[model samples]
Target: MDVCTLGDLIDVVGSPALRLHTASAGTGSPVTEVLLYDAHAPLPHAPGALLLAVGVRAAEAGPLVRAAAEAGMTGVVVRGTDGPAAEAEAHGVALLTVGEDTAWHHVHLMLAAAVDARSAQGAGLGDLFALADAIAAATGGATAVEDPRQRILAYSTVPGQPVDEDRRQGILGLQVPGSVDNSEQVRQVFAAPAPVRLPPLTAADLPRLACAVRAGGEPLGSIWVVDTGTLAPDAEQTLAQGVSTAALLLLRRRAAQELTRHQNADLLRRLLDGAADAATAAHRLGWNAVRVAAFALDSAAGVPDAERTSLRLLDLVRLQCDARYGRHACVLLDGVVYALLPAPEASGGAGGPEARTTADRRHRQLAEDIVGRAGPSLRVPVRAALGAVVSCRDGVTASRADADAVLRLLDDALPVAAVDEIRPRVTLLRLADVMRERGELRAGAWQRVLDADAEYGTEYARTLTAWFGTGCDVASAARQLSVHPNTCRYRLKQIGAQLGIDLDDADERLVLWLQLRVLAEPDAPA
Candidate 1:
């Protein structure tokens, strides 16, 4: 197996300041050794070794950091709350910093414990595959590990390999597809805290034995094994032991995930809103000169519990983004979930028109993909919108505004739309709100049109609105009202006569169109 990663050490320490530099390749890069550095002695050089340095001069620090990278060191951990971050980031090596009170010996001990825990599977600290292997070895059948959300974390097959379609798909996709996952049998597996004996759904399927891997009162995940003629005498006891191991691993994973989520949420809002300095934001958010796009999620049409649904769906989006885009940030804001996604690395890093275009295309495709994959689990359809891509800092604010504009244009109307694609509607929507606030929509020509309709029992206002909306096409206006073209023309002429406005004047048409948009009911057709 590969050595544990720098990410593993970070999770063990659980500190916000120990961040991977933006230019570092990835947190998953393997760490094969851990060592300490001394300024008086020659720099300790070892491939994939993480070196911790203390009390080095600023002049010596820069050269030592550069030499560490050249020596093939995986990363360098330094003391102090702050130091030459830019120099370290430029070298593209993981630069970690621990608090003043933390001792080098203490860090070494922590790293050693974390590595050992990760290496031991049956002991219940880490290594999902080892845990699965142990279960399969004891039960004499194929084994799999799954979370309560039905995500398949790991699996191991029987020695002879008796695999079925369901098991194959679960391994291939890393989770059972919603069609197979949303079943009464799976529901029952999570419903109880004890082990379950499940009967196969069809002749093609096989019976299974499952046990929940839980810590505290909260259910973490489950372990399952195929049931053959009979189990070994100690198979059930081994399965129980595996459950304890899996539960501990899951608890650690969940804690790390929650800490990451909270940190990302805080940094996302601050960086986008320009509430943090560029250097601090870059260190925390872990991106620089990167194209950033925003997206928002809300409930579909006719959903009574829109608030609750949006939050739930938002969580699914966050999980998917975390799984797919390692350098992304997500937050829930004002009943909507907002995300700041970095453009793919394949796109050039500079913030130019070509990069923006590529990022916009990617965001649109990502929006479609998430809706297609996770939409079914949501129970109700969701409305989503993508924004333009911009560089970090003030540009993020503009990107957020673009996403919010697209979202406002969504409401219960559209499935998904990009900001640039709906600029006209977005402009009109904003204008309508401004007009309403200024009392322009409540009085003047629109009010007179409404009053005229009420007094004379004429449908002139509706006809005029349709005519303007359809760009003066009498046939289209007639179709909108389900009336004859001649009737549409007649109503238009009556509206002109009553309002004393020339139908041919472009200015008059523009004013009437604006009024109609502002007066349109919240649920009215666009």
Candidate 2:
């Protein structure tokens, strides 16, 4: 396995987010961990660690750099160039600067990717940068490898290579700039069987030759190269050939990622079902938190290609949660996506009286965000239910039960809701579950009403349901059933005489109403 050095990490995570500010003796040190620096917290001695000094002023970064050096850290990344470069140099530690617009989480993701790739080097993971360089060399032009979503995975960095502003921005942002209208170009490339020449979208953009990478007829990604009219005559042919290799690499990476997802999902399922030891599972999953919550998400009914939509939603939820929490567990069971989200309890700070409320609000917001994004991106209506915040992993099962109950009760109006916010409805749902288990409505007044409706083509059941729903007000029930008040009263009188029951008995009315509601459920037995 190749050791990921500080210089290598910088190369993989390019400029506009991170830039080398000062070179020192530790420039080639291997980066084994990524740490976020806190002034008030004690800094542990982690050798070869890269520190991200988020929210720290450059002028006040002298002590951090000295501390990093003393702790055998590789480098420190700050937001401004006014950082203590001299101190870092004297201490034999490197200093790096982050772009003002770049977020700390984004930097952490980039660094984590670089470090993870290095650690998985022995697994035959293809080097995308090397492939980009190879393609650039063969075609005599700058090159970029992009996923299907137009995310730039790798790009050639050879000096003196001609590249337009669009290419430069794509490399810097690791995505196709939002300003560019390339939907038609993407469609054309994916539909073509050979390399397609795409005209420049704007005067500032360059013409390109691109080919889609496919495996088993599924589009995996694409390769794009700048066409400067200086390429070999067979440049298109070379790109066409490179697609085969790109497909293989992409397939391998996807398989590895899928394997990991399955493992995590299996463990999450066991935890949610109380089939696994809570403490051991939590430790193995790296979820170190004082509290946790469960979120159940699913698409609304009658969605086209529901299975496919469900899988897409699962992927989106996992990505969003992983990006936000850095450590989360998500799984898809029975077409619903389940996520276990940790509270903001790092270092055991969430022990206050309002800790559960704070966690509920935070997790609710995230669930709402997921549902909101799913609508515009997947073109499908989605809903999410947040469970109660629990103190330990053992309580996750109950939280999951709450989430599942809320999901079952969700309607078109409520796209996101927490268990606490809908406790009454949840309680009714639980009661309905118990009623179903005991077959409470099988041979009761409700069943008799159903039998009479079927045998005589009567609307007795409907009338009774409306009567009870209207608090036994004859006029209101008549309006609900679209009949005269006398007709409603007549039906009620006949119902009492036919069933030999008293309509004035409070206990009987309550029990009868409960049975009627249970019978109204979609899954009720005939």
Candidate 3:
């Protein structure tokens, strides 16, 4: 159903006596229904309805205006006096007044006819391209339908005039360039409900006529006709019809996109959780790469509309990923948005040291691209963590765990991390998690050494840490601890004697080193 605005009503039945009290800045409020009322009659709660006030008194105007606002009416049209302009403005409602001598029947009939005419406009539009074609043919210009973000959704097949740089770039790239995005004319077009006529930026430029495609005062996107010298009355009429048609098409497009997003999210969740056949899901999604690299985006709490902001960020990330790597998926899980990209040819058909190095570089590049592209557009600060690349066929769960582990490092200071890039710290953190699960690790000789140090204030744990950290170099270990090399040797002997272990054994040294690291920060990694 089409909506009738107070502006339309004014155009229909308004005389010199009728004046607009409140100025609706953007597209005016849309009214789909109307009600007739008297000052003393029952207050009707008809949201989105225009209320017609008949035989209203000056003193009763304030209360009636308040009543209409509270009843969720779009606006109130009354005769006799100013109709409490202050009260209407305070309640964010539109106020209009008719000539005192105008008949009540005439007022009602004019409003009804205008509304009926509104309902008849923008009817029988087949698709977005059809609407775009109609607008372009009527105005004799090139037409493109773009979202609020200026991303092109559709364009007319017929270019009615010679294309300019903006139109050509927008159609080819499917988005407005940053240079054009910052234009004052672009801002005005979004802010105005009626069509905006923008003169050329320079003598060599083309003029543009634009209008917002909106529903219920909420803008869906905009429709633009480029190189139109000046719109004729018929062209203006066509533009109005095209705006309404564009709104309906955008609404349908949004509905279909939301449905597809929900379905993809579900399938992705199952694949990440290892609860469904990942191969099947991957095939369905047209992902054929051999490795899967996951990117986890940390949620920014303590911000207004955090969920909505995060979802928008997720959409931006998905767009960037799709542009770079065609087959990628995204999902919001546990307050964080995760992206899974099919890493192409990371190992180069040889899963060796070179392959690992190649995979690391590729994953790092992917992570950087996402952060660079989506980071600036985000309202709230967000941290990004990229996981190690794993085999696509059998490592979905492992890849997610890697991503989650990387995300655990996010803090006020450390905002981004990659598991492969920080392998040593990642290793310690992973081992820390294992240490908590296996209590039997506590009964090892290294634990005894740590317990003895706690009991006798010994430096065994510190000595072992320095020694292993220096790769078993006694002098370097001593230098790191600010102690003599002989003292380091003496402590090592005491550690082996007290813990009843062999310092010469490689296995014993490895166990002692791991034990010291585990107890170094015994608390589980976040």
Candidate 4:
């Protein structure tokens, strides 16, 4: 143990007046596993989280109170001493002074050691996160850990909508069960470089917001210091500060790993964005040549945040790369895995018959891999659609369009196991073919209408559009256009003359219809 009794620990950490514990046998366990300070819980509320001992000396009473506070004790019992009553009364803490007992010495030392032990066992920030949970589980109190930005990267008993992307983001939805307010309040209170009072969650709310943090001299994040009851001022601050420091040390170590992964993903995105030189991109990416494809995976309808699932699904793509093509960045964007396959320059060219065959062959294998690997996680099955690759910039655009098409088709037909099943070349091209067969110039026509609407606003654009589509047949067009025949004819002629288009042409009619559809959604195909 670090020190022999609560009296010895007082020198290291000042004494606390409010906390109390009963350690008849020195197991160091509190009377109960839960405590609530200033709470209106049922009376005869025997403390299950902490205990009060009768024999602790009056000099030892101070630290015992501190330890009880740190350990979440509601009260502690010590031998009657000159200052005990006054000290406890001043702190507004419930105090009990009893007779001396031998267990006080060893128990006190154990408490001190417990405080020092965390520092002795040095750990990095990431490890602190796990440790916080472990502490909470053992103590049955709440704990939370937050990153440098005060964002809770991870915590025990997370709120329903916890954000897991950054280690430094504030822990949103932390509902501590104490006088402490929300997660933000906790951070601001203890946010200093030195450990201090972290406004904790309330006793009731903490059942859910138990969390931890990791913060050292600078603080990478934070680990929680939680007990069911209110802590003694001195012990409370000390333990929270010590563990929080340890948590920060662990957080920094994991920071490097997360950063490398993000950097790789970013570099790959630049290569694919077509903003950089392809040769240099290929070389930097460890590719002599490459084939790229896109897959958009959608969570089953009515599912929540399907996009977040991309991280898990992305692993499947990684599995394929590992087994076949080798390691490469696998990116998740808009619910799709923008994947690249590395190949040799020799395997690339001929630009035709052979190229099509090879592309098709690799394409099918990739499809099979994606389809085979896609499955249920978190009780939801992932569905996917894929698009064909375009040569360079064109390919990127086409893949995006195709990826979207696959998503639509998933919305339309086939329970195709996942979004990956929608082969970009095939499924996306098939959509293009359907658009062609439907006599729609989705992009060309939509853009024209959009440009017009930009100048004309909604009503006129709608009026002109409907009139044009009806072929100047006032009555017939008016009925279809849902306007008076006179109005339809007038609008048509005026709009036609203004835009310089014949009110009766096949091309103009088609364009107007495409425009209506495109302007309606703006993001989707006509």
Candidate 5:
């Protein structure tokens, strides 16, 4: 008797087929199994192979397929367009749809076709799509498209017919004309923005219809199909074989295009805003003051200008932060990174991933550090600043303040700046001024030393700044100033008297903390 494996049979038949088998006796009888059947004509099993025949009505597939499997048969083959195909699968057999109408050849020719397809090159998505269409037309089945990437580059139906733009562009509304699960299946297929199996399609599903598109893998955006509602037992076997070749071609196309990809997300944002140039429209969108994290890389960096490098770094930073902190508009003025991370209007908000978390001090610190690293890489000093999470529109306000911090420090450094120099106290000062001007500071009017006229006085500010820089250590303050420690102590006490502010109260300490930090700002008095 002759026998064959699933892979071996496809090469012999010149068509697709699933291998199945069954016992030749009643339930529980020991029946030895064998292979090598004429799947196309439904001929009797060869002398040594076990054979079991059944009416088409049996819905359960497990028992029959399991019996054949246990009997040591190589595999089972069944006509897919009939109810028995479903029954066979129910019994745990794999179904392969050969054709909708009738099998044209024996197992031997089908295997040969599968082997030839796998071995050939220059036979890409277009070629495969054409092959599906040709095979379906000749064998009596549906249309086909073999896209492994989401490119949707090519498709063809029975023989000479190919899908037109009117049909494909309007694909969203069309139902699959196949005899299988048409509506639900087509819907599921379209829902995935990537390439994947068509849904609502099942084991008994034949090749009465076909549809496919070309796409790439990685995220696996590609399409291929075994078109029909009726197929020979080995039809699915062909699909499995062709899919690997189709997927490889799809990936090749995508990899080739990766070099040209730039962030078009910004363009999408603008289209959503009813403008093609979104940057101009960004002004109208609500910007927030949430913290953002980002990193940067350059296309090529030799002889890069500091400002140009900073801008490129901003682009890279935006791309990665998109996964972490979320989308925000980028605006670089001079040589600084300015971005706005959105704050949700309410919990469970639908903002970017950054919206999932609240303001994190570490995020701010990290972004600045990465930006700072870019400065040395580009031979340009870079500094960055972050503001506390604030409400919408306040983000734009905060961005301005952060940029100012970077600029203020850039000129005072080693001709290059780093992010750590960004002073939040500077932003707080700006915030305080904004709040006071807008009447929001009424929440803590009297306690705010920010409003003290004597506070901004020069000598008193200088003495206080020097004392605090020493970490309240009088001797350090004196030595740093080349003055007596007692003199530093007297200056601090006298400044308190003039300002009329207690140095020990929690409120007073808060004020002192804000002031001392502001004093650290670049170019501020020691």
Candidate 6:
């Protein structure tokens, strides 16, 4: 497996978030964890751990750096421009610094993500940058490997190799620069049987030679190198040969990614189902949130290619949630996508009405954004429902239940809602579930009304529903049913007479309404 070194952490976090103050003996050490330094706590020996000296002053960081080095830590990150460089070098520990304005939590998250990403992608794939460097050496040009989406996976950093503005931007963003248009070139590269040369798209771009990497006739990605016209005589052959190796590496990385995804999904499933101890599962998954919220997403009804669309929506939701909440987990179960989002500390800690409200708003907004963004690409409407924020681990199941309830109650008119936003509907649905399970109100006046309509084709049940729905206003019911008021009144009288019930009795009307609601529920024994 690849080791995520202190240098990798700095590269991932970039400037402002973290900057190297002192490069010492352990600067290149593998970072296994990120820990916050506490003066009052016991100094635990954490080998290869990067310590964040949160609140430690520049002048006070000398001892922290010495302590970290003694504890086998990779480095100590302090807030300020200067740290004890001499002490760090003497102690053989690296000293890093972050801007005072940068939150320690953010830095911690970035470091964690960087370390996790390296561990996740390193299995059996070797080092992609090393491969890029070898290819660049063979081709005599700076090289970059990009996935099918044009995301830069790795690039050659061989010294003295010429690079253009596009390469620099692509490396910085980990994606192709948006200023250059290469759709046609990309198409040709993928379709070409062998290496193809592409003209520079802009004045700042150097000409490139690219070859599609394929395995089992499936395009995995492509490799590109600057064409400085100083290529080795066999540069084309060398790049073409490298394509086979790149394909294998990509295939391995993909397998590793899928395995990780499956493992995460299983853990999330267990958490949502309450099948595992919440705290244990959260710890195993490296989740540190004290509270979490659940979200349910599904495509709207009547969407063609529903299975494909659902999978796409699932990917979209997972991507969006990961981008927003770095520690989130999402899974698709039974055609519905569910996500468990950890509440950020800024939203307030695990309890209180204010915190809950803030978390709810954030979750609902995320859902709305997902739905809106999914529409055009999905070619059909999508809906999302959010559950109330609750304590993490054990409370996840309840939150998931709330999300499921809200999703079931959602309609085209209200594609997104929280449990509390539709509390009445959710309560009624819960009651309907109980009534159905108990077989109550399943074979009484409501059954007879349905039977009457089925047998005689009478509009008695429909008229009664319209009347009740319109608050017993005959004129409103008539308009709703698109019939005359006198006709609606006649149907109501027929319904009451047939059922042997008084239409004016408050108790009777209440029972009848409840039965209607229970029967209206989806799959409620027809």
Worst 10 residues of 2 by lDDT: 290-299
Model 5 TM-score? 0.33
Q: Which stretches of candidate 4 lie over 4 Å from their true place?
A: 1-264, 273-277, 286-289, 304-308, 343-352, 377-409, 412-503, 516-526
Each model's C-alpha lDDT? 0.69, 0.77, 0.70, 0.48, 0.42, 0.78
**RMSD from true fold, candidate 6:** 14.0
lDDT of 4 by residue, 389-446 (tens): 4444224445545555555555424534223444542443454456656654454444
lDDT of 6 at 368: 88
468 in model 3: Cα distance from truth in Å?
2.0
Candidate 6, which segments miss by more than 4 Å at Cα?
A: 1-120, 124-126, 284-286, 289-335, 341-383, 427-526
For residues 1-526, could you state the per-residue lDDT of candidate 1 as single tens digits? 3256676556444555354443365776667777777768887668777877766643356776788888888777776656556777778667777666777788877665555544332233347777898889888778999888778887885577465677888889888656663367777877867777787666777777788887777788889887764766777778888899888777766655565566567667665666544454544455654333433444334667767777786777787777767556777777667777775333365666686677667777777776766567766655677766555644667767777777766754466788778887777777766776887455667677777878988887788888887888999999999999999988888777878867788887788767766665443323
Which residue segments of model 2 deviate by more than 4 Å?
1-126, 179-181, 232-234, 277-337, 341-343, 346-383, 389-395, 405-415, 422-526
**Which ranges of candidate 3 are over 4 A from the true structure?**
1-126, 159-161, 177-182, 227-233, 289-329, 349-383, 391-393, 410-413, 439-441, 520-526
lDDT of 5 by residue, 398-434 (tens): 4344434444433323322223334553455565555
Pairs that clash in candidate 3: none
Give the candidate number with the greatest TM-score: 3
Q: What TM-score fits each model? A: 0.52, 0.48, 0.62, 0.33, 0.33, 0.54
TM-score of 3: 0.62
Model 1 stretches with alpha carbons more than 4 Å out: 1-52, 60-71, 74-126, 161-205, 259-329, 333-336, 340-385, 388-398, 407-421, 427-526
Off by over 4 Å in 5: 1-304, 325-328, 331-333, 346-383, 393-395, 398-424, 427-526
**Residues 1-526 of candidate 3: C-alpha lDDT, one tens digit per residue:** 3455555455333346355667443125776766778646688788877777866764467887888889988888878665687888888888877777878777777676556555443332337777788788788788888888888877887733666787778888999766653467778988887887788775656888788889998889888887656555666667878998788778866664454455556667767787655554554455544333444444544666667776777777777766676456688776677777665444555566676667567656766666666556664556677765665556777877777777777665766677676677777778877887888875577767767888999888788888998999999999999999999999988876767789799998888778777656444353
Q: What's the CA error at residue 11 for candidate 4, in Å? A: 55
Q: Report the poorest 10 consecutive residues by lDDT, candidate 5.
A: 23-32
